[model samples]
Target chain A: MKFKIASGILSDGLKKVEKVVNWKHNIPILQGVYMECTPDEITLIGSDSDESLRYHIPVDGENVDVVTPGKILLPKQAVELIKKLKGEIVLEREEHILVIKYGKKSQFSFVTSNVEEYPKLPEINFDGPSLILKGTEFSNVIRKTAFAAAENDIRPILMGLNIIANSNELIAVATNSHRLGRVILKKGTDKEKQVVIPAKVLEKHLKIFDLEKDVNVYFGSKNQVVFKNGSLVLYVRMLEGNYPSTERLIPTEFLTEITLNRLELLETLDRIGGLSDDGKTGVVKLQIRSGVAELSTNHSQIGKGIEILELQEISGDNEFSVSFASKYMMDALKSIDDDYICFKYTGNLRPFLVTPSSGSPEIEETQLILPVRERDV
Target chain B: MKFKIASGILSDGLKKVEKVVNWKHNIPILQGVYMECTPDEITLIGSDSDESLRYHIPVDGENVDVVTPGKILLPKQAVELIKKLKGEIVLEREEHILVIKYGKKSQFSFVTSNVEEYPKLPEINFDGPSLILKGTEFSNVIRKTAFAAAENDIRPILMGLNIIANSNELIAVATNSHRLGRVILKKGTDKEKQVVIPAKVLEKHLKIFDLEKDVNVYFGSKNQVVFKNGSLVLYVRMLEGNYPSTERLIPTEFLTEITLNRLELLETLDRIGGLSDDGKTGVVKLQIRSGVAELSTNHSQIGKGIEILELQEISGDNEFSVSFASKYMMDALKSIDDDYICFKYTGNLRPFLVTPSSGSPEIEETQLILPVRERDV
Candidate 1:
């Protein structure tokens, strides 16, 4: 494309899209960023087969000039080098070569492959139904629930987070068998539908959102989902499968529930976890007696660690012992925002839930961790 | 060891000695730091078979108390964790266990190995004489000359920098066959012999300099050298064989000698070198004419890049074209400290030299580079 653009502005746009650029050999063109210069704006697109990002910088109201509306695939390295340059850059396309000139230095034209050689991404029809939510709120829902998705592909369905939007409620749930994270949002209408989005793809797509304005989401059938706001468009393919039934995983009763300062409990668990025999099977034991909870981990080789944390109230089970994977407990505890955290458990083997102490009964933002199987000591 | 010291002080001392700490799986005790506690000072020693570091921290004036004088081996991980902690940490040794307590929250005890199990470094008797130089000045000399030493151990002798010290001058020379960097310290006075010090050991040892005081160097036969200052003793084993003759490599007569601003020429070479093909021989071409110098690099695939630098004056034989590895040029250029850089050459294939454009020829530090074999364009 023939154009003269501000280096800083173009660099900012290219960097945002570069995060999505795939360097895999499956599709060589995908390794390069797509630069399309129109009379009004210059769009930069980078993507792999699963997710794609499109960032545009408007030249109509800025100090930019588009001599010709054209398209080209810029090599990843060249694009990065040009972005790091200063001042204004003049881009001129002469037949198969693209020459860039800035200041008294001019880098000779580089050979460019024919635009027809690049794979054409389907023009997503934005005519599909769309929903708008605050960028920050949408990002929070994705991050909080997405982490619970299964990293192993043994069961492909477990790798996707279930997103269900009903008439008056929108719920998101993710589980990796041992742990699950859920977040809920209130909706205005009563209509409903369910979809499973690959957590890996969704996480990569959300990186382009600056969390400024409202982000719009649209999807149709098993085709793809589109998120756009301002001059950026992120498209992700929807996973084709039904999510596992997590409704039964939630506990409806609790024998022991107590509220303790979030930081204190997290720090105590962290210290006790140091003595875990094997890092992965980090089973931290929690013994609650009176108003103090002694969190500890005992290892024959590295000695044991015991940390006492004061609790406000731990009634039902006066003195109970339960063990959990250290990582699961730490992740759940970190997500609690309230000054005090409440841990509810039905039994030692059953799933235990952690939520903000100030959380309302109707609130859906709660972290759940399934206790590990333990032999009595 | 029985003592109570501020966690920050202990951590800082440990970090300084961490570079030489054993990370291999050979001697189990090598993975642990030796802790010796005295009423006045706490000495921490860490070592690999090849390198050893002993750091002492005075506790008499600090928030420290010594209840007993003892020596014990504490695992590196335990020491690192204690360092991460705050407040005064008490160290108590009972049998083979080391109990570390800080506040009421931290009570960790690690199994310690017997201090006697660790390998003891041989004491080098210092009956010979020694020379001292300011720490900063010595460090600068090492930095300027060390990079030219051979990185690979193919020629063990070349891996060390040959140091020749006479009554009036201390000459440091390092070469990797491709290029040689010679720095002359005419300011120093010594009635001494020549000694070759391993570049790698010297590099690590130089960091221990106090920056305020002068460092002493003592050399002896049997391929051994010792550096001592106050309580710190650093010993390095010298190379077995003779070093290459660098004096014969430098050309005595030059057909051309041109002077230019050091920084300006270096920057121009850097920019032009970007276009030079890597791996096959990174050769950047420099063509100097009357009052003008052209820097260029021709890459078979990436086209050519050329930049013209205006020269104040150029006095040499009619015409000459030569090319050297860009990396060697950059390394030599970086070490020169001069407003004007003087380039001297006898012929295209012969070794050319670069020196500061100034006074006494004997005091000048020279950088020599062997020209790359010329190929047909």
Candidate 2:
């Protein structure tokens, strides 16, 4: 293979797919980026057995001037070499060696591996109407809820976000049994289907979408889902299991409901959170009384922190106290994007929910956290 | 201690001394900051077995309002709490607990350890003259030569920079047998004395010095050194050893001399350095020819990198090749603060010196690196 490409354009595309390249033991070739150059465009592909990304960079303007159409599988070392160099790059294949010359003084001749040995990304089939939405909208829905997903493999099914799409609404839900996060996209449409989108895929999804353009989404064989925008395509494998019923976990009836300026309460909790960091049962206590909310954390080794924070409104909750894992609740509170936030809860041990009152690109997002069992101090 | 002080001013003083606080298991009190509040000033002191720091914050401005003078030992957690807070801070002792109140809503009641249990920082006596100089100059001299000091505890003596003061000259020299760094402070004066400053202390010294004002430096009892300004003082325990004579190591006779743009050569070497990083000898081969210098790195897995970099001049015997640890040479190159640089060497395996041609704030600094044995390839 022989071709000449601009460094900036090529490096940008490589960086996108590089994150998906597998670094697992036993399969050394998967650590390389698969490159295919044509007269019109160049395509870079990377896969890690679970997810695959194929990004195409067209010969737009003067980004690439192809001398010959060729394909080469370049390892991470070559990618690092190319990313650091400036100006134009010329790549030529000679036997098992791929000679890459960049700038004026630097030239690297790297040994090429067998590209044929690497598993091929299956061709996705799509005939029905797919959910097409703006990149920002797709990324926003993922970001609001993905953090609450279970990271461990103990319950493999819980390691994914339950994505439910109906005729006119789409909802993303993630829970680690202890905490739950939910986001609703009010303007999405698809056939009634529920899919558990792997947690790792949604993370990579956020980084790949850059340009503010429309993205197409479709599912394949119940086990695979695909996301694409003209030149870039991503396929994520789905977890096969029924997710736990979380609808009943979020209590509708509440004894108390409080409204607060979101940032003020967040800052107050962060200041008091560190006190409960020792090996004791991690609990950050929140008590509400006389139109104010007070947070406190007590640890045997690390001392105690107490803070009284102002609220916008406190109606039903005259006097109430609850204990929660500060880290889980903090994560839930941070996911909410609004100036004002609402908190609703039942009795002491009941699970509580924090939600944004209003924000731009309005969509409902609910974060629910279970209270820890209180101990006598 | 009871004092209402500006949190910003107080925390700044605490941070300087905090770095010296030892977190060793045996001496638990040494892990705490020794804070003494007076009517006019507050002093923050921290000590490890090897070094101690005392920083004073004055109540001359509106920064402090002392209610009562007292002393307390605050653990790492309390110090962390204080550093993150803003605005005014009120530290008041209530029995064994130190009640720290910040902002309007936050309060932390941290149990304080006995201040008397912590080891005392010895009083430094400077009977004769001391090496007093600008903070920037001291920091610059340390920065330019200290990197070459051996980091490991293998040869305990090589873990410090040998500082010599005779008549009007102060020279700082550090060598690990393989490499050497020397800086000549021409405008320094003290009694004829040669002392080895601990490598770790020099590192902390760089971070502690803030203002460009004068810094008073005095060596104590041939084993301890004290560095101080009006409000801040640092005492470092000196390393006891006779330093090797490195002056004779630098060769006066040169078989080949090459001059090049400092940044350009550094960049060229950096670009080629990583190619020889995979279990290879990891040497960046520098070859000088007629009016040009070419740098190359060859590795079995990551291919070969070759670059012909521009040079200012290549006088003396031009045909010469030498190999050096790319990492070591790169580090030595980065320490130099100059536009143009000159390289002088005797033979293939001989040590070479890299020095600045001309630069401002110029106290002469030299970095010498030994060549690695070349492989027969």
Candidate 3:
């Protein structure tokens, strides 16, 4: 393959696919990005076994000159070197070496891997009907829910996020045993469908999608899921195992409810959480009574902290106290774009629910955290 | 101990001495910062074994309101919590427990560390007369030379930068056996002296010193060297061993001398160096002949890179080649404040020198890198 491209354009393209390029691939060819040039476009493909990314650079203008319509497998280091060059980059295949020239200052000739040795990604024919969502909104939903997915577990379903679509609404849910996050979005009449996509795969694809425009998403049962927008196509394998029913875990009613400024609550939790002894679980006790909420955490090793936050409204007659993970609560609060947050709690041992004060009814968004057993230390 | 101070001011003071606080101290009390409250000023001190810092905040216009003159040690977490709080911070010590209150929003109470258990720094006696240097220039010199000091070695002196002050000039030199950096400054000296200061201590002290003013430095044969200016005093222990004589390592004669733009040469080395094999000994070859200098690096596993840099002038007819650690050269070149750089080479195995073309005697600087022996793979 031969082409001339700007350094900025090349760097941008290489970075988009570099993360998916397996660093420890047993197959040497799998570690390289496949560069193919056609009459109209040049494509760079990088993949492991589970996920793959294909980035296309259109050669419609004279800015990008394509000399030959061939293919070559370029090593990871070659792409990095080309991206780091000072000026316009020129790529040419001379015999077995790919000669990259830039200005009169630098010239690098890197030996390319055999194009035939690299495994070609299968041409997936399942063009499932796509759903369009604002790129920023989709990104925000993924950011809010993906963190609750199990980071490393043998249970494949726990590592994936379930997306359920109905005629009126689309719901996204993710749970990692301790915490669950659910986001809802309103839509017109559409066929109902459900699919589990790996959280990591969706996150990587989101980084490449244009934040200014809408993104198209497609999925085919338990086979594969695809996200395509602009010049990038991201394909991910679907989780085969059934996801746990998360709807039953979140409570719909509460014994006590309180409304507090989101930023103030976040700050108070952060301060009190500093004294927590548990590594991942920062058990902070919250007692809301008489338009005031008291947050406190005591650790045997680091001492204790007490933070008093003013409540906007409290509608509880009797004093109630509950303990939950501080980090989980903070993460849930940060996901919503509302000034005020409403907390619904049952007692000291039951799960507590948190939701944005203002959100669309089509989006049934709520975050749930299981309360820790209250004990005097 | 009781005092009311602005939360922002206390946080700034704590951060000034945070670097000196030992995070992994074997003694628990050493991990805490000692706080002393006087009628006029409040002092915060943090120290490891090698270095100690004392930061003072004067009670001016109610910025600090002292209720009692006492001293206490606050743990890292407690201090950080108090610092992050908003509005005025009140510290009240009742027996062993310290209560910290800020506005009406937060109140944290924690057990204070035993102030008596913390190690006490030696009382600095006026043994040597004070010497002054522009804080900006001293910091610049240290920044340029400290990178060459050995990070980990049995030879303790090699980890320190040698500082020599004569009647006319002050010079700092650092070497890690493989490479060396020397920075010289012209000064109106009153006395001549020589001392070796640990590179780490010099680096830490520079952060607290105001770059716009002059810093007063005092040193003695035993114990610690103190840098005091205004309300800040930084004490750093001097190295016991003798520093290596670096004057003998600089080459006097050269077989080839070339002048080139510093930025172009720096960037060229960075790109070509990417082709070198990974390790501490990543060598990039340089060949200077006629009026052009070519930089290249070839690895058996990766590939090769060649960059041709235009030279303004080239002396000596004989062709010469040398390979040095690219990182070391890059660090040395970054220290020079000049548009052009002059490279001086003696022989294939001799140490080479790099100097700025501006030829400012007021700021004399030199970089030395030893050549690696050529080998056939």
Candidate 4:
């Protein structure tokens, strides 16, 4: 394969695909980027079994030119070298060696791997139930819900975000049993569908996609999903398992509802959380009476911390107290973008809901946290 | 102890001394900050076995007020909590508990350690020989030479920066045997003195000292060096050993001298360095002939990378090649704040010198790197 391309174009394309390549993979071929050069454009594919990223650079006589059409597997080291080069770069293949030349007097000779050894990317069918959404909208939903997904594989289904489409709403939900996050967008297909995608893939998409563009998501066969935007396409393997029914996990009624400044509550929680017995659990107690709320935490070794926050508005309950993981509350508060937030409580032991006091009319989001049973010392 | 102090004042003071406190120390008392309140001011001291930092917050009726004179040892956890607080904060001691009050209804009760268990800071004789210099000047000297200090304690003396004062010049030198960095300032006392200060302490000082102020440095008799600036004082134990004579390591004669843009050479070295067999060694070869210099590195498994850099100016030997660790060269180049850097090579096997092409006449600095012998494959 022989091709000439602008340094900037190649660098940008390499960066997008490099995210999928694990250089230390036991299979040497899997540690390379498969490059195919044609008369029209150059395509680069990088994969790590579970996911694959394909990026294309079209041939433009001014910035890109193709002298021959062929394929070669370039190692990660060469990819890194090309990314750091300036000016136009030329790549020419001779047998098993690929020579890359750039600048006035710089050149690199890379030993290429056998292209035939590279695993084939999953075949994705274009004619499937597809949905189109703005990149920003898709990224927003992922950021809101992905953080709640289980980080371990003890329960593989919980590590994925369950996406359900019905009538006119597209809902995304993620829960690690202790807490849950859900976001609903007011746009979807008439045909109902549901699929659980690994939260990691959606999170990675947030970093690679251009927010100004539109992304086309296709629920392809063989448990594979494809996201295409401009000249870049990403294929992710769907988690094959039945996701738990979480609709019943969300509380529908509350005995007490309180509204307060989100930032003030977050700060107070952070201060009290420092006194938790164990830094990991970060449990704190919240007591609401009249219009005042008190947050406190005590540890035998670390002392006690208390903060009093005045509620902006309160209803249904004159007094109540509950203990929960301060980290969960902080995470829920942070996912909200509104200046003011609302907290709904059914009882001390039941899971409570946190939502923005005021948000967009078209979209709805909710966060739920299960209170912890604190043991008296 | 009872006192009211502005949050910002207390936070800033805590941050300065907190650097010296190791929270994971086996001795519980060593993890606490000793606080002493007198009628005039509040003194906070944080210490590790090797060093101590003392910060004073004077009592001004508006910003600071002392209600009673006493002493207490506040735990690191409480110190962290106080740093995050806003508005005015009041502290009152009742029995063994210290109550910290802030905002309208927030308070923390910390169980204080016995103040008598806290180690006392070394007493220094201020009448000993002392030197004064601008904080920026001291910081610059440290920045230029400290990185070359040995990170491991295999050679205890090499882990410190040797400061030698003679005539009107103050010189700082640090080396790990393989590489050396030296900086000289054109201001010193007539009396000659030498001391090796731990590089870690000087590096920490860089973050705490205000660059605009002048720092008074006292060489105390107890093998301790004290740096005092305004209301802050840092006491560091001097390393006890004889520093090696590095004068012989810097060659006055050179077989080749070449000058080039510092940034361009740095980038080229960085790019070629990526091809090193082992990332840690990062060895690269430089071949200089006439007006051209070629930088290259080859690894059996990673292939080869070569870059031709144009020499802005060259003299002496017409042809010579040497191999050295790219990381050392990069560090040396980064430390020199000059647009142009000069390389003076003695021979293929001897150590070479790197210096700024042009710099302040009052300051002189030089970096020496030993060449590595490459084994033929």
Candidate 5:
């Protein structure tokens, strides 16, 4: 667009939307940042068909000045070039070409794509059943479960995270069938809504949002949702199929309950996990006894590792043992940021739950892992 | 094998030799580190057939105590486990199973490979024509040229760096036909020898060596070269081939010479190089005029970038132009550690030279780039 903006401002706006740009779009024009320049503001939009991010840059910024108002689509290269250059970045359209100039030392020109060829970004609705949560709370719930989401699933619905907002709590759950992570947080809202979004969509926006600020989320119709905070807006398309009942999947009863320092357990799991069999099958045994829990992995090809971690408390059964994929356990253990974490399970094959404690109402978070079943081996 | 060694010391020793362990070895035993523990010292050796590194961990080091003498071959897992654990690590063999214990909290058992299965390290002779140089000097020369070594080569000999010890200089040269780097350091040795060593071997050893200390280089027989200093020893196989005479390839007479700040030119090259047609075809033109050198990359698909840099001096034709792979020029320019570098060329089609100057003769370094022929494009 024919506009002069601060390099930093443009770089930040471009970065937010760049992640949503469909690099593999059938029409190459869709793989560009669509910019609309008006007398008061400039809007940058990027979309990957399923999701989009639209960021607005006001003209009142300290170093930005609008020379003219126009619309154009700039490729990733133009954004990258501006990010590296210093001082004011001036963009002027010459026919179909966009000329980018910085200081007096350098100038870059890109053949601008036809803005009309780009797909329209998903519509954003400001009024809807919404949820309001601190960015950190929202991010934490997503972070705990996103990793458990199926990466490339045969059942595509499993690739999305099931998000439910009801009453004062917002719960997000993700699973790849083998393991599940459910994070429940207080959103301070009474609105109720349920939607499943691609884990990747949440992951991308998580990278940019300032976790300390409040993020407003709105459900747009049944197929779309929008997350907005300050000048940044994210649009995500809801999955069509049904997500499995995650609550029933996480077992309700336990024969044993053990509490240990989260960091201590994480470190121990990491060491034992180091000797995983060929990286693919990282099954390790957790022998919980009085005072200590022994984490061990015995692989015939690689080696064997036994890590003894001191337990904070133990109850229910005096001694118990279970086997699980070490990587899955480590992921669950690492996600918990608490002084002590508790583990509850009923049988060796049942999915165990890992949480901060059995009685913490301030914040609710739980991770469930299905043990590496002996039958599967 | 049978010793109580500090975790830090053992980890450091394992790290140095780990690079030599062949990750892609067909026989898993060959990838193991052969360790021999004596009453006084523990020797750790790793070999990938062509190259090897042997590091000695003395028992007298802090937190180390030898209870007995033994030998065992430890796999990557065992070493990695010990590297992560803290406190004193005790390695004691229980028959064929080697128990690696750290403090009383953790223990990892690796089924030791038969000592006879691991390949022996190359023989290192002390009484040979040798040269000594500060590790920094040795590393600097390698750093400047290693990147030019053919990564995947039809001419396998080009994958190695031709090192010549003649009269009073130790010169190292590497080229992949497209570009060349020659580093000539005044080693002040009279011994004459020439060997082409696989650049990858030097690169691995360079990663572990302390650049500030002195490194000993020994030319063993006609097929092997050994590098050793303090507790570290590296063995590299020497290639046998007729290396092209590098001295003749560098032109003494030139039609144009331009001098500019090395950093300034490098930065400008980087910016102009960013706009390459595609990552694969990075041709850029250097237009050297009276007072300024204009670096530009004009690609029909990716667009064009022009960077104007001030020139300190220019001679011959008032303006001359030449094109080369922008990445090659940037790599060569970045390697020169000089405030100002001089460029000398004869014609657009001829190879050009980039060096600090004609006067700084203490350690002469030159980089050459062959212009991309217009006919080839």
Candidate 6:
């Protein structure tokens, strides 16, 4: 391909697609980014077998000039090189190599891989039911629930974020059996649908919607979903298998409720969490008496750490104790965006709910953590 | 032990000494910090057996109040807890448990280790040869030469930084056999001595001399060196081995000399260095012809990158090409505190010198990198 484009434009385009490129893939062609140049625009595609990213840059006479229309495959190293260059960049194909010129005296050349060997992007038909929402709102929903998804593939369905959309609301839920995070947005589409999107795909492509713009989500072919914003498009493969029914997992009633400063509780948990000797699941006990609550953890080889937190507000049962994995509690607290957080407890071993005291009118966020049995601790 | 101290002061003290504490050590007591509370002051000591750090906080009856004078060994977890607390902290020993009270409603108890089992600091006789210099100056010397020291223990002597002091000058040198860095300060004492301090010790304790105060360096007892600044003292055990003679490694004469902007050269190397496939030792070729230079690197499976840099000044032989490890060149260039850097080459394969164009009058810095042989590539 022979084209002249601004270095900044090419750099930004490469960065958006490079996130999906598996640079360490055994197949060399899989690590290459396919570039197609036309009279009107240029398209760059990057994929890692399951997911793909496509970025389009319009060719304007001022910043971008197209001398000829062709195709070439640029390896990860070449893309990295172009990102570091300045001024305008001119790329041309010569026999089996692609020559790139930048700045006043810099020239780089890469042996292009056969463009035919690059896998074609999965066909996405946008005729299906679609939903258009504020990019920020969708990102916020993902941030609230994606972290609770299972990171391993042992339970493939649990590794995907389940999103159920109806005419009035959209609910996103992610659970790894122990903990669950759910966020509901008071906006949806005309048709009702539910799809489980890989949490990894949602997180890695979150930056694409960083700008204050609107994103269109489309349910494409079976097992395929498309997210489009401006000239950038991302195609993610949906996880197969039925997601567990988690709607009833959240309890609506509680015997005790307490509100405390979010930051204070996080600090207290962080301080005492290290005292527990359990490898990854350090257990800390929370005991509430009168208007004060104490958090403590003890290890046979280490020591004991205790911190007392003054409750801002308390109701229902006044005295109770619960033991939980400190990391889960901390994660639930950090996801809160409010100064004060409220906790509702049912029993000692049941799942507890955490939410912001002053909830967002547009989005409702709820975090649930299953407490460790006293005997287990 | 009973004492009430401001959390900030105690936190800062723990941070300084905690760097040497091997928290993952097999012996539990070895991972503890020894605290001695006397009527006049409090001393906090942390050691990993080879090096020890002692910090003294005087009892001025304001920030510190000692009710009962005693000693205790606080485990790593306890130290971490205290670092995260705010306000004044009152630590009182009650039988086997040490109760720590902070804020209004926070109280923590830790099972303190037996103070009698903690290892004692090595005794040093302060009557040995000593050199007093600015703390900043000593820290600067360590930064310049420490990175060149061998990180592996295969050659114990190469893992230490050699310091030779005399009435006229103090010289510091470190080398991993392939590259050497030598810095000389035009300040010293009457007694002349040479010692090899472990690079790990010097690097770990560099933060203690960050202030602009005067630092007293004492070559204490055999195989021991002490660095004291104000109330903070660091005891380092010298490596037991004969340091190799590296004075002759630096070339005195050169066939070619080139001066270029330091930042420009660094950027160029960084851009093209990744094109090579030699793992960590990516080699880039630099060719100087007439008054211009070209840097290029090529990998059979990857690509080729070339950058042309206009020379600011050139002397001696021109039209020569030399290849060197990009990482070594970048490290040496970063250590020079100058805008323009000068490169002196003795031959294509011999070790070359790198220095600042406007050399400092008080401190002379020299960096040498051995070029990669063509056959090796």
Q: Give the per-residue lDDT of model 2 (tens digit) for A1-377.
A: 78888888889888888888864535777878999888888889988878888998886546687777878898776787788778888988887788889767678888879877777777776445368768878777788788889989899888899988888788888998988988888865745778998876787567778648777788665578888876788888888899987878878888878888888777766667755544223478888877778888877676788888887877675898998987887787778778888888788998998888665554778899889987443
Which fraction of the native contacts appears in each prediction?
Answer: 0.23, 0.71, 0.71, 0.85, 0.83, 0.71
Which ranges of candidate 2 are over 4 A from the true structure?
A22-24, A125-129, A278-282, A359-362, A375-377, B22-25, B125-129, B278-281, B359-362
- Cα deviation at A237, candidate 2, in Å, is 2.5
Instruction: Provide the clash count, candidate 2.
Output: 0
DockQ each candidate and list the results. 0.34, 0.58, 0.60, 0.70, 0.66, 0.58
For model 6, name the residue pairs that clash.
none
**Is model 6 an incorrect, acceptable, medium or high docking prediction?**
medium
**Candidate 5 residue lDDT tens string, B73-163:** 8877787777787777789988788898876767788877688777666566765537987888888888889888888868889999999
> Residue A277 in model 6: shift from native, Å?
2.3
Judging by TM-score, tell me the better candidate of 1 and 5: 5
- Prediction 3 TM-score vs. true: 0.95
Misplaced by over 4 Å in model 5 are A127-129, A188-191, A279-281, A358-360, A374-377, B127-129, B279-281, B374-377
Per-residue lDDT tens digits for candidate 3, residues A229-343, read 6787777888877888888788877887888899989877877777654433568988776667888887766677777788787765548888888899998998878899988
Model 4 misplaced regions, further than 4 Å? A127-129, A277-280, A374-377, B125-129, B278-280, B374-377
Please tell me which predicted candidate would have the highest DockQ against the true structure: 4
Worst ten in a row by lDDT for model 2 chain A: A273-282
Candidate 1 or 3, higher TM-score?
A: 3
- Among these predictions, the greatest lDDT belongs to 4
Score every model by TM-score. Answer: 0.87, 0.95, 0.95, 0.95, 0.95, 0.95
**Second chain of candidate 4: TM-score?**
0.96
Q: How displaced is residue A81 in candidate 1, in Å? A: 2.4
Candidates 1 and 4 compared: the better one by lDDT is 4
Candidate 3: global Cα-lDDT? Answer: 0.79
TM-score of chain B of each: 0.89, 0.93, 0.93, 0.96, 0.93, 0.95
